[model samples]
Target chain A: MSGPAATEAAPAVERWTPLSRISVVAAVAIIAALAFGPLVLNPDWVDKLTTLFIYVILAVMWNALAGYGGLVSIGQPAFFGLGAYAAVRLADAGVNVYLSLVAAALLVGLAARPISAFMLRLKAGEFAIGMWVVAELAHLLVNLDGLVQGETGTSLIAMTAYGAESRRAAVYWLALAAMAVLVGVVFVLLRSRTGAAIQAIRDDEDAAAAVGVRVLATKRLIFILAAAGTAMAGALWLATAISFQPKTYFGVQWTAYMIFMVLVGGLGTFEGPLLGAVIFFTIEAWFGGSGVWYLVGLGATALLFSLFLPRGIWGAVESRFPLRLLPVGYRLRGAPKSL
Target chain B: MTSNDDGAILAASGIHKRFDALVVLDGVDFAMRADEAIGVVGPNGAGKTTFLSVLVGAHQPSSGRVRFRGDDVTRLPAAERCRLGLARTHQVPRAFGGMTVFENIFVAAANGGGFSRGEAYDRCIDAISLCSMMSVANRRAETLGLLDRKRLELARALATNPVVLLLDEIGGGLSDGEAGELVETIGELRRRRIAIVWIEHIVHILLQVAERLICMDAGKVIADGSPTAVMSDRAVIDAYFGEGAA
Candidate 1:
């Protein structure tokens, strides 16, 4: 089982320790298996998982924005709707659906700069409501023109070119890829200087400013990042549905679901949202056929989780175990252990 | 802006600060030499801390000029002033409570002082070691006791590699032994030629490190001279120690 004899001059300290390497490798292997799932799973299951992936992205983005950045926004659906509309319109114009998805997300990211300039001026609760107002405004404007077909809605006709099986497979892979890339970006950023500065601002704005952290600028960056990732998830959702309505895309329910997922998972930790998304998706898949009871159950579950486990499932687990699958912050190591 | 001009690292002239008709600082003029230690003594609400805040860019003076090495920095923000090597510790000991002790100093050295990554790490280690905080360097700042928190406040400011350090009542709540330890740290800092302006109620501790001492009351300087003379001045005795105290 041993690959080689022990080297006498191994490093006393390592930035990428063997334990961390194992975590990274295990994550990559799991992702690869998920990417190949459409090959064996039924079309309906692949479709269900595609929806789960989009929620995963939403939950993760919301967690970072609120949990780490101290910006609890309720208006993320604004960009989500914009991205969905962009994707549908581009596909209608005969562009590649995949390319249109990316372009729509980028367009949303660009719009975030100006949006943040206005929204970030508001403090915590005001900021949350401000985002909702922005989403409502976007909904009204999208209905103003025939470009989105207003209330009549529209479909992604470009998808008709592919067979049902191939279409399902492509959509699943696209969702998986988008989730991996966005989560990976967040992971990398949380390990960098920008992440440190953002956490500093989260802890104390005045102290962070005194230490030369550009407070407003860092908030703006996080706002834009959350917007971009949320928009990309929106675009993927449109691809999954192959159809969209303004009311459907711009619903406040998206924000509610995001909050539920992250709240039940944990706030600041990386594993919280991922674990939350899986649990929520599993519960929905099992009991969703009951319609209104399903939603009621979800609401009750969220309330119970909030009251009993304020830190969420992952948060509780982390407190007990101190497990860090993605260790971004530093932990001083003891002297090297003897074999 | 020359660092050697007038041999002063910081100069504030005709500084005035008011909050809705309440004058916190009244036409205060102060200056610090490149290698000097000055002590400020006054009763509570005498605007001692307010003066330090104005000097460090935490407050905007109503009408005045603040010169750092002969360059006006009155309009600059707190972060900019910190980056330019003017740093201060808060009276309440504000440490970055969520971060480790080492991370707190690292952030100050890297961001406030503009040191490179390697140099900032070195500077942080040096600062904590100087403050005798190496044992708690990995601990979260919020977990520290009063003495360690005070040490962290000082160490965090020191990590900024300041040209002129403004200290506000860091010795107020310390035991005599703890205060003595802090005095030793400040003495070591003075040996490095860093200008120090310390505001303290502990007159004896102030007398030990400050070559020149100034007394203020009702937002104006009442006495300015050598430490011994200022301590014994009739006006200082009346304003700070009360007329009855010998």
Candidate 2:
């Protein structure tokens, strides 16, 4: 039989808050260096660091949809490819490059409205797989037309129009800026009342809905927001490479990389995905073209970590020593008030 | 609390519900004054749970009108009903298993009652203290045992700040002392004048609390009156207490 309910003593009931002590300071310092590392590095390494920054933004978007919304999507490449295609098309049509990039991201968000209607019909595993199929089909459909030059793909002449050095530097800074904005947006969202609703629904949707949460609409909004961010990351990737192919832009490898980063870093918390992305990028840069063995190594590492530290590295660290790197959501116990 | 009985806080007329032609509530009609602590006593399959579900918008009556505070709310969704101050517990406490004990209550206060974070926290803490589940507030609902889970369930409903609270067997799984403590807490609620409709199999407990008692069977109320009179009514004695319940 269940005992009398456990009444908390005031101290134990006090809400947990993370302190930005040495650990957080160290992590942030490291991240800052990583983002700007391209500026201080040899010219050869600039493109790679910029790529890592894009990965940071992409991981955050994926984590937001899966970790926070409980909608684990394996088809984020759909948005990524859409963003690239939009940018390439706009640059082709003689539009200003920057405006095209922004429009490209927005278009992905808008398009997600209808896509979600169909995808949301499936739940959990089915939904995740459905998104993957959507991405693959999108890639196939887009490749069939000469719009993006089919399988041969098309060279993005904008980087040439802008020249090599400035283009490289611009892409690097833009990726950094995008990651920062995505992180900031996530922090703001986590702090809002809506964030609490999202977290609640993620934990127990039926209970959340019973308590007046609009589970479907809220999730749809997150879907669009996260997709838009991912699309922007994809667009930036294409610009950095100055090219796009159906296979490359919509590659399932990007999905694999995103999932690995999130799972390794910490799926739910802010800064975890960023940290994970940095770690994965480091691993990739060091061992990238050493063949498929590199990927196998990363997967093996993830399997061990997932088995041992299911919450991911940052999740474990956060529990032992709280660091309020991203302070969102309310802490209720310190003060007493009349309702 | 101010009495607002004339406002007809809850009304049900011809509330018919069926489960594939096995009629549950056969034209059940009932009404409650504001802050009235009414009791619903019934044997198994009597539609008492179904009746409460209709009141709380969890189920729709086949042909009936349900008005709350003189406003028609038969078609409103469950969340809207919760926002409008109608809340209920499950017969078997369906606490959110994945959420923390505190979070379960917080959702109801914030989403169900439209309370601000500070306001919702206060109400949630208050409800937790009343139900006495605060110690496990940080613990996942999945980890809670039967009695504590029931407390969590009560905490959730109470956090909604309902004007008309519908409880479905909160005392069912509890021990005598636990039930007695809950009764005392509920008695305090009664003094504060919150309208309550408690459905239970425990006759004496509701008799000790509710001013009026109802007995339902086959989806219809067979008896409704003061506790003592209804407890002794021929049909109630036969169906509920039988000859040995005297």
Candidate 3:
């Protein structure tokens, strides 16, 4: 035993294990299958998939902000509105509709930088409501402008040039790609040194500062990044419908759905949001058109998940199974030769 | 490493701290030499923890200058001060409840101490072992017992590789056996030549590790000298066991 132990140090287990490998393989297979969806699926299914992608993006971004960064925000729709408006205004100004979608995301992300300086001042519960107030203000401000027709709504005239089939495919593919990029960015980020600093701040701001984390700076960065992601989803959403309405973009319902998805899936884990988004999409697709009962059903499901599964479905599953598809923490194995 | 020529590692003069109308530390002047462990004791609300907070930059002094290695750092943030080799443990243990015990120390080593990845990993492991918390290093801090939490607090501070460490009430809730173990850990740190200023109510435990004792009362240091002498001082006994105890 001593000879083997001396010959090689205890096996250092990294975050990536055999289980993670399997999870990754499964995820890649699913993504590849989804990529071919528009080719085989009916137009209605493709449209539903696009909506699912948007929800997934929104849920993941919200989780990163509130669950990991400890900045609960109810104002995500503010950035979403900005992205939608930017996309519409840019397209109206004769920019390529697809290019405008990308530009809108960038602009909203840049805009969040300055807003963060003010918004991040509020803590926890106050921060959540403060964000909602900001969104309402943004909604009011956007209505004052005439280019957006003052809440009369506007369509993506540039995209009208494409055939219905082509437009649907473009929106589906872009939405899927955007979701993949956002998830990939968040996944890589949480596995980095900066991610560690951000999580430290989440645990205790004072303790994090004591350990040399630039608290304000880290919070600001996360806020802006999450805004960019939510904005991107909003922009893609505008492309999907080819119409821009301030009320829909800035509505509190958008944020409510994001919260519900993250809460019912898992608040902090990467897999939780994904799982939550899928479950939410399936339920909506099956019963969404049932109107009042659909809303009631969604509410009841969320309440049940919260009451019995506070960690959400993914969290509960993780606690029971101890599986991590996107592990971001370190794990050591085998005892050292001596203390 | 200090440029004071007198080998003073940390110096604070005319330190005053106030929260609204309440004055916690009143015109306190304190300094420490290299590798010296000073024990600070006081009656309840004597500003012992407040003074430690001031030294570590957790609480900015109302009016005073804190100099570390001859450079004025009164305006520097706590995080900056920690990175500059001034570190402290809280009176109430503050652990990152969501993270494992090792991650808490790792954050200190990598972020506060500015160690690289490999060095931070090694330092975290060493700190856990030093604190005799290797068995629970992988456990979440929230799940640890009180003694383990205190050990984690010390390990977190130690991982920062401070030249001067301020510890507040680290021995407050420990049993005799656990306190002895903690004392041995602190003794090893003392042998390593790290300057320490410990604020603890347990006089005997403080005396076992600290070379000198300073007693405070109502925001003033009434006595400062050798442990045995300070403990027997008229003013110190009066502050602790009442006016007639001396």
Q: Pick the candidate with the highest lDDT.
A: 3
In order, the Cα lDDT scores of the candidates are: 0.83, 0.79, 0.86
Ranking the candidates on lDDT from highest down gives 3, 1, 2
List the candidates' TM-scores in order. 0.90, 0.86, 0.94
- lDDT per residue for candidate 3 within A120-154, as digits (tens), equals 88888989999999999988888888877778988
Fraction of native contacts, model 2: 0.33
Q: What is the TM-score of chain A alone in each candidate?
A: 0.91, 0.88, 0.93
Candidate 1 vs 3: which has more TM-score: 3
How many residue pairs clash in each candidate at the backbone level?
A: 0, 5, 0
lDDT by residue for model 2 over A55-144, one digit each (tens)?
888888988898778889989999999899888888889887867877899999999999989998788999999999999998988898
Q: Chain B, TM-score, each prediction?
A: 0.94, 0.93, 0.95
- Which ten-residue region of model 2 chain A has the weakest summed lDDT? A1-10
Give the per-residue lDDT digits (tens) of candidate 2, residues B121-142. Answer: 7888888788876557666677
User: Could you tell me the TM-score of candidate 3?
Assistant: 0.94
Q: Whose lDDT is higher: candidate 2's or candidate 3's?
A: 3
Please state the Cα-based DockQ of model 2 relative to the true two-chain complex: 0.31
